[model samples]
Target chain A: MKERIKVALAQISCKQGDKAENIRKIEDNVIKAKQQGAELIIFPEFSLTGYTVRDCVYELAETIPGHSTTVLEKLAKKTGTYIVFGMPELSEKTQATIYNAAVLVGPDGFVGKYRKMYLPTHSVFEEKRYFRPGCKAGVFDTKLGKIGLIICYDIFFPEVSRLTRLKGAQLIVCISASPATRRTFFETLTAARAIENTAFLAYVNLVGIEDGLQFWGGSRLIAPNGKVLVKAKYDEEDLVIGEINYADIRPIEAFVPTLKDLRPELFDELREAAERL
Target chain B: MKLKPSVLDLKWTEVETKIRRFIKDYVEKSEAKGIVLGLSGGIDSCTVASLAALAIGGDKTLGLLLPEQETFTTKDVEHAELAAEKFGFKTEMIDITPTLKAFYDSTPIFKTTDKLCKGNIKARTRMIYVYYYANRLGMLVCGASDKSETMIGYFTKWGDVAADISPIMDLYKTQVRKLAQHIGLPKEIVTKQASPALWPGQLAEEELGIKYETLDLILYGLERFMKTEEIAQQLGAKKELINKIKLRWVSMEHKRRMPLTTKMQYRTVGADFRLPRTLH
Candidate 1:
């Protein structure tokens, strides 16, 4: 377990449903991140296929350990690094259903996969139309350490990150294809989640114009203390690199012990009262 | 990147072209024959008139002079004429005193017939004439009010504020003055003190209790989301005045929004169910 892990956030523009082109860009970025001496490289939500693919989600959905993962696995091995990205996944249990999934690949090949737990179905988002909610959340042990993954909209619910951290994840990677609206919320929420969980949080967001909504690419890396170590340029494609010290999380937790002070009995009682109401 | 409020600085030529194009496209989309506006000879009205003329053409623009007997000066009529003549737009004069007096005579309910009540009557009277011509010519009424007045709720409700389109609505008074000059409006109209001309000796600055210069700076600060003390310090003005402006802005929030409707149904008009006016 390394004390400090270098992570690179690749904020890239995605052409709608252009899998080949997006894959090429992802591969190129992996090589670039490797050159920059980053152990883990991250990409925005739907970096494999693209966001806003309404019905095309069916056509774009790929199976895990499938063609796209095979390519990404080779890229990770060749670059000697770990790669995490978002895509529409064909549910293994029920192949008919699609899930917004994030795949993690390292030098050892496929590490783990996380389907987005919360499917957003609101203004400008119709993910519920195409995706099934992920069943569970857990952590993946990489060479860097125990790392957790959650797609967009999952961060809105605190339980998602908390559960991941409880499952022994030291860092959480939140990949998003978020638009400019409510951008301040995303930024503040990422920091808030990091501080609350006493875990390192890295967010990579898509940039450029997509379906008339401008995606703000203010990707950031936040320490457990809610310190923003690096933030990428807004509305522009750029690589943001930051170092996460695994040792930093220990002292932070030792000082505050937010997780240690949890009262699950009270939380369960509150949940029961809320349900009754 | 951090958002710099300096991006709001006006480039006169680009602004002019954009507004003209916007008006032109709006008129075309609304399927209105042209535009009609009440010309008060104030900088706001003159600027709107110039833009309307540039938009739909002088032949399609109609300028109305609705002057109350006591409130309007001869210089007001002359300046309005100067703008109309320069733009080559047709003008008609409607004496609004009789209309105002009719309301006063019919409803003697007001215990006090003060300047405020009378000024509102004048504004609504002019509104009637502006709409009358607009209806006659199949035209939309273009309002000449600017952002500074609108923000403070200075204009009378359903009066000069009523419009099918407010072309200069986003520009502040100072910016409007700059635009009026840039469009080659006569110096008389561009340099004149802004007045609603609803009553005699009613200057907009005096009525609003803030000069357009100071108001614009404070507004710019507000636009950039600056704190009141920061704005006051940066502009070398009073913190009290900045706070007052902010209070006025908050109090006048209703004027900026559509009337609130109770949502008893799943979808209420302007509450849950909203479609662009241009949508079929």
Candidate 2:
């Protein structure tokens, strides 16, 4: 039998700017994921404070060891499972700046945090106005495996996942608060990222209607070979679990050889020419 | 098999709340007093009227009965009145026969007396009244076109489809009917046959030669990328019927899209130059 790790993708609706209520729901899901024997549980972007917070994001931003994590750390300790969720972070270094950030916690408490790099400014997204983009891609070492964290819009760029994979991340988790519109794009893009990186991908999305926008919840898990192992139904909150086999990564990369074939020198040349233009 | 498909299942309460909030938000943001809709006494119009009433209260909602003298039925007018009474919305009746005659007598092109041409005029004439009242009352014109009719180009270009916003455009005709009943509309209006009421006894199913139920199923199948044969099997309908619906859906695709623009520059109006009206 292959070495399997159980992961839970919790697709739940978050109330905008209601930190206390959202935290209660998150704590409940932590207990639920643990009951199902999930070693790792993930949530959609801004799961602590709903997406579309807009101007209220400044008011909702919290420090990592602030009120939210203090409560979540206790839940992680009680459940004995790793909890990964999205929230707006009040920067410790820069008091005035806020970043759209994801935090990771485990039984021991306070694993790591990754701020989102890409702030979408077009269409329905006005994220750039509120979020100051993070400087680095983040990978955290956990008991289940080495995990990479990226927020919703970061997945649109292939470099984020590629860099995380090169850093020896066996599992990549993307937390998204994507809307119903352009849902097919998210589905296709996530699967492609999993295949190209040869890493197990877990995606969690929020659901519910707010401010005239509907967030479609089709949270899913993709295997290293690019097959969708499990997918939650759209427009509903669901807790879906899938087993990720870490052993499958090596065999898949050996066959496809995407990472093995080095093209960094060619990419640098293309980058230099584009810079001249 | 499963007699009732789960595809049509909807959380009507959640849907209603979302739409009500949508209407309320749009009206408040646009700074309009209310919304105005033409009530043909058909299921579509009735549903729109009810939703508008629920959103902004019946006192703010306006329903107009713009009936042509020859083609329009008195029963539809009666049904419209009943809906108004049930929803407590204000109503007005405008006989548009004189307006139609005024335009017809002026144009030599109208001498041939084509039904399609006359129908288009009637529809457009009603829109003129709808917008006139909407402007005078500082309200937005609500459209009654649903996804089923919208998919097959069943509406006139700038006539029946003319509106500031559509509350029910995403719902199919079958789903609209379900919503009608869910909203506690009178049984007579809920079960009434759908028609544009362009002419007397102009049944929609009769003109299309396909029932709304089957049409909705075919559309659902097509949207899901099912083959014609597979849809025929699933709906227990003929493959020719499925193919005809598919062809109509494909051919009428142009009607649902903006008018074609020849690329004159790096970006066109609705092509690469993309920004929602909200940004400006």
Candidate 3:
């Protein structure tokens, strides 16, 4: 018997540098999604800290199991829905360095944490200055299904998604604060990742203009076949939900045979070259 | 000519039309032909080309497609051609690979495989080509960069960044798409992925590591909503994405403004460069 999971993609507009308001907004959405019978509710990237609050990094960054995560833990327990969200998590031992982390809070407690693997340093992104990139890819086993969470920039690279899929992730969730100018590309890339990996993808993006830039929210859910089951409105805030029949994924995978066609030898060669560099 | 007082209260569309008309009249009064823009086949260039074609007839507007060895796909070239065809302009393609190679071969700094340096050189090389053509053709160099790209210093310093006039500098990428569609751009040109074509298989998103969609969202969240960490939590976006965006805002602070001055005196440039010019 295949498990059926209901997922919700929250396309919310984040206020820049305002922690209190953002938390209130998330709590409200979590309750709303749970009430709608969603098993898993995902938010956009960096939901706690607004995307462009450059000067507020040290001010807003908190330790996991600290204020923000503790609140999320309580919310998950109350809602009985798994919550996956992004935050600037400060390491316990290394207080000076910060990690761009995604927290998974289940009904019991904090279930898992996945730090961003790819730290973009060039052109409108200078992550090397602020973040220490995570070294490993993570997939958490949940009652809903095997879930994988990758941050915004991590989705651009195939290996991150591939690695998570290899770890047996049936559903891959991406939280994004993608802007309007790059919405078209994001949509294309997200769909591609889902199709190639043979996994259900739920993508949530931040909407509205922050600072001087604009975000075009086209949050969407893609089936394993690369078909968009549900897409959120761009440039507007909305709650998007979709039902996944895990039974259907196997047939699609059997027909397409993408996973069966293994080019590991070629990938290994490419990996070796990257390692040499 | 008398200026109407009621014009101040006009709707935004009316005001925009008036401003455009005023500029057009001024250009015509000066006896200048239509604007000349270098169409790089990227979003910025396409916007500039469309505007130039609209400002002046196709005959008056000139669109130049500059290509180098690093140009990943000919689709960019195709898009530029289609834009010119749709907008009614003269289109020309010039390969700058030889010129760039010549410069690289001569320079001692080319020993190392510094992709950044090489990329910058390509941009500069393209700029030189545009300026040269614009000069020979006696036309102004229209810039296609948007405020989003300019704000974070994503553009080349003196390369694709150089321009005599920029029409869309204040518009965000989202706004640019809206305007592009509003202007009746062909689907082929409008749907194309953006790239500088600096290197083979080079995509703007892949190179930046941060998708523009997310970058734009963060920028919008910070600038408009003023919701800091709360927004991040609400969206479930990675803190790293936020951090990266913030880092860009801080690091590229220099690119967003005029060159800094030592401020030795009270009347230095940038701080106080305002002086009434006396024309003889």
Candidate 4:
């Protein structure tokens, strides 16, 4: 594994439900990031379509390893750059069901995807109405490093990132379409998640407004020690690049050992109590 | 004045940044050339003008100062011109007296004593001119209905309230005042008494029967779902007054929403069906 890899976060506003336009922009970002010597380029949640896609869910939903991934895979092959992006996945098992999924594509082809586990259905978010819950947290291995993937709301749950870290992932990528209202929560939690899991956390958030909702594009990358290495501009389109020193993970983990002090066995009683409730 | 609750004090810098982004993004999304808003020389409109100029350059922003004869004042025009000068947006002086006179002439039912009707006509006339510029120049109409007036249905519907987008409507009048000052609006504009200037000697506070300083807090309490009694107790105001404010807030609900439609179909537009953000 490489000791260091540069990652680029494409914090761009999306044209809602315009897949072709969005894909064109995504490909442009990938090329730019690749030219900047970034091995991996990250985009925000629903980068293929804007987040306020209530009625267009059925029309915009595509199959995994489907057209978007296929197009991205070819672009990956051409540029030799790995890309992670968010798209609505139509469930093959349950034809009518859809999932908010994060897709990973590289020089090899489609690697894997993580469906969002937490479907936030409160406030401005009605994800439960549109998407079925994702099955589990997942980690995909690439030439860069062992990488874990999560969506916007899943960052709230510590177990998601902890499980990925315990599964031997060094970096966690969270692609979000979070708005201005919940910015402080995401910012504080991203750093906390990295500190506890002792893994690099790169958060890429959507920019621009849709349907009266404004998104604050404060994409940031946090090191294992919860240090903010780089941050994007607020409320505007900005491409921010940061280096992921894989070598620092071990020393930070060895010194802090936050992940090593885990005691999941004790949570069985609390889990049982949750079932009782 | 007693110290207001801390909740009303927003971080102006953050608020301005977010609102600026919203204006700039909405302008881009609509693919419009610039923004066109009726500048009444009030705190609300001046606040919007300052922010719009900051969001998109002042060269792109257009402020129309529509002065009718009955309520027209040199001071209003001067204040508006000051705003245009401070923020680099261009200003146009449009005398709407001719349009109002035509409305009265065309309508046989027009009454000399009906100041309310005449005021509404003036407001609607200004909208036509503002929208005319918007259509001709490919710009979007930005409305300046602040939350205090909006919650109590103080605006003339389909008149001054009509807009392609409302940038400062979410803010209360007091909040708008603070924001206006923070955005570098002159003290004359920021401290000016709230008025629609539909007729001479007309004031919004006089018509609403309450001060914005108190009204914003009542609306804030109601927004939090606080009981009228609780709000009265907390704010040290009368229960009846709080109840009255709450009634105005709820009774004006129709003003804040689209006209109701009976739902017989599986889904109805403006009820369950809504346009996608991209389409808008």
Candidate 5:
């Protein structure tokens, strides 16, 4: 028998700059995901205060292990479910700096968080104005497996995923608030990441319209073999539960040989040469 | 050369699904009882009202037909009422001839020949009624302004363009026609000539000096930041025509945004001070 654990993708809409209401909605879905027997529940980018916060970052940004983490800690302790969600993190090293962060918490307490490495400044995204890009990727250990975290535009950068996988993360949860225009791009990139890394992926997205941007939510769980396990409806709030087995990817990783075939030694030289450009 | 279907085509089922969800989400978030829209019996409003009916149900969506004496026609009334019945929404017709007459009687320089000023009065008058119904019923007003008109400043400010939310505002005029057909609306309604009906026999294509098909393609090219010459080459159109459209598109920027003010404050409301309306 395989050791399987269910994962829930909570594809819900966030009220922009409203942390209290957004958390209330998140809490509701956390209970529902737990009721459906999901051991790990995930929410989309800026799930705490909503994306497109603009200058409200001054007011909405929360310190890690502060109000949001403490509340999530109580929920995680009660449900016995590990949760991953996004929030605007006010930096501890420097209070003036803020980073878009993907946070993780379990039954024990807040485990860790990965600040998003890429702050997309182009087109509809003005994240660069509000966030300072994170210096490193994060992979955290838990009872289920080593889980990794990535933000919306971070999925576009393959280096982040490779670094996380190289650090021994078997499952990567990409929390996004991607809009309608970028839907096709995210869909293609997600499956590609899972197949290349030979790792399980859970993509959770925000739904609903904020101003003129209609977030087309098509949240899904992808297998190591690039197969879709479950998908949520677009432009609507949905909680989709999918099962994952940590041991299932071991053989595929061995057969595919992606991790084994990587040549970091040669890549270091290539990076040094390309740096001149 | 005509633009390819691959360039402008849409999977209307997906479009319909997304739009219905937008309507539902907007109404839900605003905590409004239902949707209210001005029904001109043209393709845009008919299509919008149909989508609203599908989004929240016919009973909740109210379509108001505000026709005046100069532009009144039985065929349009039939079309408007038929659309209401077919699309499963209720309709109430009000003769705005008296309102226009009242303004015409009271105001100075209310020349009957000055169609532009009188026409604007009619458009603004229709909005007053629309907003009144919305206020009375606690329903959000859904504007039927399409993107093509919106981009080129074809809509009347604070009148036809005013609404709590405009679901079809993202779609171009030609795209809205395709959407109307896809949703299985009546051919008569879908193919009807669009008019603002502020004046008698006033067609949008005639006033704009460009057909919707060409206008949509030109707008599409311009929106992509294609050079006027490049847009002309692709569409097989004159560069002069393309430039004319481009100039209008640029000059009409004020209509698309809030009125500009001098940046005296640290953060200006319409300029650097940016925040989503939901937060307020």
Candidate 6:
């Protein structure tokens, strides 16, 4: 039987340094996505804690199994839908170090967490000064499909999406807090990743300005074939839903066949060199 | 007292072209060979590389792709190579993994597997290398950062944002795309996502927790004279979302300007540096 899944990309705006308000906003979006018959819902990065907080890292950071996750866990159970969202996670052992983490919650319980791997230090981004990067690339199994979760900067690396695909992720969900100056880059990049990997890609971005950085919110869903199935309005908080048919993926892969013709040997050599160094 | 007219009212494209022309003229008059840039395979770098190639002949331009252990994919490298080939510029690839590892091992603070520290080290290291090659080759290092990044102070103080000359500094994110297509850049480079490839697996939007489209729309509205409520209404965005973006803009104001100085006297560096000094 061909499986079909309906996914919602909650491209919402968030307030900087307002954890309570951000959480409340996310909860509203989750309910809306669930009511729309979405089996899975994805929120922008740091949905609980707004991006670009000034020295509020310690104040806003929470633990993984802490209060924020508990709320999401309950929400997932209540909605009967899997939820993926971003937050600032304070390590249990070390209070000083924080991680920019993405947490997944299934209807049954918490599924998995993936921390942002890339911490940008350049213009308007000092993530390296705040959050720690994640080490592992993870894919979670869910009723919708094999799901891969990657935080914002992780999407820029094609290998991350490729590895998720190799781990049997049919759909890649990305949570982003990209600023407005780089909007076109985000839109084109997400579609390219989907086309190259032949996987369904859903990107949820924050809208509005945090601190002085402006966020250009253009949340969107791309099919395995790289066609934009649905795109959210720019600079707007929107609930974008798209239908994914597992059967359609095979046909798309058969037609394009970029993944089959990959030069793994060359990549292996590169990886080997990277690891050796 | 009312202030003089701000330069912010010009159309984005006109402003962008003026900036590009200014940089090009400065380089040409200086008798410099051409511009050299470090391509991270992100949108900013690609845009800058393309513009530099166009400003000067591809023969005089150079694009360097420096990859570390955590660089996500070879696609960016491929894109840079393809761009160089299409534009007729010299291209080089240098791996900084050994240098990064050696430095990390030598520094006690980086011994722990803290991703943030490691990522920053990589960024700073890459910047050092870019300058090393730029100085040796006698070419100006062209910066690819845009206004949004500049406004939010998202860039490293002297790392990725450092440059001898910046061509696209004034354009916003959306404006850059228009310019990229306007200048006949290939779809591959034009369409790629904006990323810093600091780690093996990373995406800019996913990491930042917001999408660029919405952010840009809000920014355009906000910067171009729309009120917060009006912006929300026009874009169909939620009021809360607009408020969030506005707050971010206000908070990150520090990143856009020079470091604050204690105004013990009436004049400070930023306040007093206004007069243009020229050697007679």
Q: Which ten residues in a row have the lowest lDDT in candidate 5 chain A?
A: A1-10
**In order, what DockQ does each candidate have?**
0.03, 0.07, 0.01, 0.45, 0.61, 0.01
Task: Point to the candidate with the largest DockQ.
Answer: 5
| Docking quality level of the chain pair in candidate 6 | incorrect
Query: Per-prediction TM-score, please?
Result: 0.55, 0.61, 0.55, 0.92, 0.93, 0.53
> Which residues of candidate 4, in runs, are more than 4 Å off?
A272-277, B1-5, B105-118
Clashing residue pairs found in predicted model 4: none
Better model by lDDT: candidate 2 vs candidate 4: 4
lDDT of 6 by residue, B94-180 (tens): 898899879977876665467766777777887888788778877788888887666555666677888877778767666676667
Which portions of model 2 miss their true places by more than 4 Å?
A1-149, A153-175, A180-212, A216-277, B1-6
Compared with the true structure, model 3 gives a TM-score of 0.55
Q: What are the runs in model 6 whose C-alpha is more than 4 Å off?
A: A272-277, B1-280
Q: What lDDT score belongs to each candidate, Candidate 1 first?
A: 0.85, 0.85, 0.75, 0.89, 0.89, 0.77
**Against the correct fold, how does model 5 do in TM-score?**
0.93
Candidate 3 positional error at B139, Å: 38
Name the runs in model 5 displaced over 4 angstroms. Answer: A1-4, A93-96, A265-277
Instruction: Considering chain A alone, report the TM-score of candidate 6 relative to the true chain A.
Output: 0.94
Residues A1-277, model 6: lDDT tens digits: 1289888988887766677787788789888888888988888888887776636667889889899899889989988988899898999999789999989998898998988888888776878877788888879887777889887778788888888888888889888999866777888899988998888888999876554355677888899888999989876677889888877789889989877988888998998998999
- Relative to the unseen true structure, what is the C-alpha lDDT of residue B154 in candidate 2, on a scale of 0 to 100? 93
* Local accuracy of candidate 5 as per-residue lDDT tens digits, B22-120: 888778888899999999888888889999999999999999999988999888888778888887998898998998899999988789898877888
Interface Cα RMSD of candidate 5: 1.8
Top candidate by TM-score: 5
- By summed lDDT, which 10 consecutive residues of candidate 2 chain B come out lowest? B271-280
Model 3 chain B weakest lDDT span, ten residues long: B1-10
